[model samples]
Target chain A: MNALGNAFSLLAGGERETWWTIATSLRFSLWSTVFAVIPGVPLGAALFLGRFKGKRVAVAMVNAIMAVPTVVVGLFVYSFISRSGPLGSLNMLYAPAGVIAGQALLAFPLVTAMSYTGLQKLDPRYNETLLTLGARPWRRMIAIIREGRFVIVQAVLAGFGRVTGEVGVSMMLGGNIRWYTRTMTTTIALDAGKGEFERALSLGIVLLGVALSINFLSHLAVRDAR
Target chain B: MHADAVRNDAVRNDAVRNDAVRNAPAFSVSRLTFRYERKVAVSCDSLEIHRGETVAFTGSNGSGKTTMLKLLNGLLGPYDGRIDFLGLPLARNPLLRDRSVFVHQHPVLFSGTVKDNFEYALRLKRVRGAEAAKRIAMTVERFSIGPLLEREAGRLSGGETQRVAVARAVAAGADVILLDEPTSSMDSASGSAIRAFLLELRRSGTTLVFSTHDASLVLDLAGRSVRFESGRVVDEPSTGGTL
Candidate 1:
């Protein structure tokens, strides 16, 4: 009971760094989604719609990446961007950009795989109809993408949810610096580790709320697409 | 109006002359073959379609009628033979893409209103504003699609959707319209209405090539019947007369 009270009191104290952590996490997640979505949707559409020799291999790689662990992604990116690594000259370590890179990598495959599945499941006759209409290749692609916009939206939102709730990548890459790189996930881990349970619990609640809202919106988008 | 009438008569005379010339041997298909890997879809030795004609390609499932239609529209390239469209070898012509259009067995509707679907093809042809509006209205009214213009294509019934599909094809001004079992999903009323619509299209100087299993419907519409058995045209009539 005393531990619970202490945690509650800590939350009530309203640490300025906690708010900054939440803001940074959100900003990082937003950028990750933006970067990932721009290429992901087109990549997915091409994989599903295009006829090319290496298309099967590309699809297989994306499907494999869908299960990649966030911490592994962070570690892999960290090796290149760290002070003594190949890209060390860029000095990207312990920064939001590093976190964004990790999160973007993590989100990209999810968006792409889901979008590919969505487009693949569409009626084959749709493509035939477009061809019969004398629509050029690019115009046909644009029309199909427009028709499947709702499914694409859901895939992007799902990617956003995955990135925003992840802790391992942010902790490994962002270094959990106060007001600079600290994010909701990292702050929650840090506060919990330090026995500041109330602040951790508050941030946890906010994270769950974000996840629920994303899932709800995704559900709505899927329904709308139908 | 008189000039337009004279132009129309000239087109009709050309169609009649082409039809007569077709009787001497109109459609020339030589060593036509297609295959997807090891699976051979179509292997026609020879075939011909007359001008101003409605030809029906009938076959059981997987007999390659649909594939033949695709080949006619240049959607699929021939593995062997040459297909000649309007005295031009199909393989060597850029005008084939502009001249031919295909309609699938199932209508594919965009996520917009029916009017938008009509306008999409017109807009592609660079028709806009009053010119576009005038043609669209004429097409919609001709096909009795005015009530359906404001409705989303997704909400249309099967018959209504097919009607709109045919309307869109006509509005696109395709010289050779290929329909694959277009009336297969419609009720009798809708099917008859569609048949009537095709007759009107023929009168308006459009050449139609379609496939159907419904013998009665085929008898009513097709001037030439091409029967298929296992990926080849088994029997064909050379009457070249309107049904």
Candidate 2:
């Protein structure tokens, strides 16, 4: 009970460390979401529109990737970005860039798979109408993306939430350096291990709040879709 | 003597235009066959739709009326035979899409205002500026759809959606329209409105290939009727002109 009160007080008081941690988490999640969405949405649209050979296999591969653990994604990214690795000269290890890359990787398949599944539910007439109206391939893709905006919005929110709540990539790549790369999830992990429940609980409350907000927005998107 | 020369010149031009229309069919399909997975959806030995002809496709459900309409408009392909548009092969004909359009049984509008839908179709044809606006205005007034111009397309009723769909296609300069049951699932008022619209299109010399179960529609507007049964052309009489 006392720990919970202190946690809220810490948040209410706007402690510098807590606020900074929240900002770092949000910044990393936002950039990663942007990076993931840039290529993911189009790829998903292609998977939905194209009728080439092996399309089923490609879709299954994306779905499989979406289920992969975040820790595994972090480890995979670490291999290329670590010192003495192929991309070692770039020196991305234990850096914000490294964490952002890892998180983006984690969210890429999520965004793609979600967007594809969402678009699959669209009425078939939309595509036929676009084709009959003489919309070229690229233009058709843009139109479809616009038509499926509700589903795409949900996919984006899911990506942001996935990256923001994950501690594996941030801890592994960002090194959880205080005043540098410390994020809410990583900070909570460290403080909890040291029996410092106040900060951990505070960050947990914030994470819960974020999760609730995302869920609320996702619900609204679905209602709008119907 | 001057008036007599002008009359002769006009007669010569009409003969030339008629010859051109006869030589170039809107769609010439030969031995076309389309399959969905393992099931054949459409099989026709030979078919031709001429310019300014109103042809009706009469078939029961799953009888390939919709599929044939789609095939005519180049919406479905990789079939077993050849299809030509305007005497040119489908792939080589640059103007095929520009001159042809298809409307589904339950038409779907884009995710914006009816005005936006018009603009999108016109933009696809590269029609912009005052020309596009002029076309929209003319179509809106013609179809009595001015009240629907700013309404969200998804919020429209079935009849309104169909009107907007056909209007959008015509405004974009389609001379050949392949419609899949344009009047199905409509109230009497909506059906009458759509039938009136189709009559107007016929009067304007637009080529229309439509699927229908309504025999009265065929009797009223079709110059020629083709029947389909189990994906095969059971009967197709010789082509005739509505003119």
Candidate 3:
């Protein structure tokens, strides 16, 4: 109980390091979500709109990837960016870029799977109407994306939540370098490991708040869509 | 005298070709079979629709009338046989979409104002500027839909949505319109409005194909009737239609 009180005071007292850690976590998560969405949404749209053999298998693969452990994703990216690996010369490891890249990779399958599943719920008549009106392939996709924007927004929020709360990617790729690469989750892990419970509990509280806020926004998106 | 005889023969041949073109069927189907997840939905052996003809497909629920309409519009495919539009094979005729449009039963009006829906349809056909404005004006006047123009399409009532959908199609310059149960579940007022609009379309010499359970619609509008039973076309007969 005393540790919880101290955690709240630390948050209320506006400690500089704690706030910076929160900001770094948010910034990295936002950038990762943007990177993931750039390619992920279109891939999801293709998976949903395309008609071909092996499409079912492709969808199944994306779903399976979404369930993969964050540590596994971190390891995969680390292998690529580590020295002597394929992309080692870029020097992304132990840097903010590496953390963002790792988080984006971790969120990519989630965004793709969620977006595809969301688009599946769109009205069949919308596509038929677009087809009958002679919309070309590109125009049809844009229209479909616009029509399902609400569901897509939910998928994006889900991706943001995923990267924001994950510890493994940040710990492995960002290297938990103090004053530079340290994020809320990595800081919490480090502080908790050193028997310092107050800051860790505070960051946990913040993470919970972020999760609830994302869920609320998702609900609002659905309501507006209706 | 010899030259005049040759000229007259040439004119006669040209006239014959023109008549044949004018009389060509809008759609011709042969041995069409469409299946849904292993169960046959439509298996039509032969069907034809003439230019400027209003044809009604009458059938019980799940009897494949809607599927036939979709096939005719080229919305579904991989069927076993062939469909020809205006004497050319359907597969080779990409311009068929420019000349034909399909309307669903509930009529999906895109998420915007009714005027926006009209603009979208016209834009699909590459109609713009003065010509698009002219078409919108003409359609609004003809349908008496001026009041509904600025209203959000999603908020429109059932009858209004159907009216806007058909009017929007007309504005897009569709020569042939296929509709699926346009008035199946409408109230009397809405149903009457749709029937009246359909009558107007027929009188304008547009080729119309529709599926309906309404007997009076068939009696009043159809130039011919096709009946469907268990995914097969049972009969197609001219009923002295179009009163």
Which one wins on DockQ?
2
lDDT-based ranking: 3, 2, 1
Q: Each model's TM-score? A: 0.85, 0.91, 0.93
Indicate the residue-level lDDT of B230 in model 1: 82
True contacts kept of each: 0.65, 0.97, 0.81
- Over the true interface, candidate 1 deviates by an RMSD, in Å, of 1.5
Q: What is the DockQ of each candidate?
A: 0.46, 0.69, 0.62
Query: Relative to the true structure, how large is the alpha-carbon lDDT of every model?
Result: 0.81, 0.89, 0.89
Q: Count residue pairs with overlapping backbones in model 2.
A: 0
Q: Extract clashing residue pairs from model 2.
A: none
lDDT over C-alpha atoms for residue A75 of model 2: 91
Candidate 1's TM-score: 0.85
lDDT of 3 by residue, B46-125 (tens): 89898899999998999999999888888887788888776556663544778889999998888889988889888888
Write the residue-wise lDDT of candidate 1 on A39-94 in tens digits. 89888877777878888889999989989898999999999999899988887789
Global lDDT of model 3: 0.89
**CAPRI grade of model 2:** medium
- Candidate 1 ranges with C-alpha deviation above 4 Å: A1-19, A79-92, B1-28, B87-93, B239-242
For every candidate, C-alpha RMSD to the true structure in Å:
6.7, 6.8, 5.9
Candidate 2 residue lDDT tens string, B128-242: 9899999999999888889999999999999999999999999999989988898899998999889988989999999999999887788888999999999998657844543
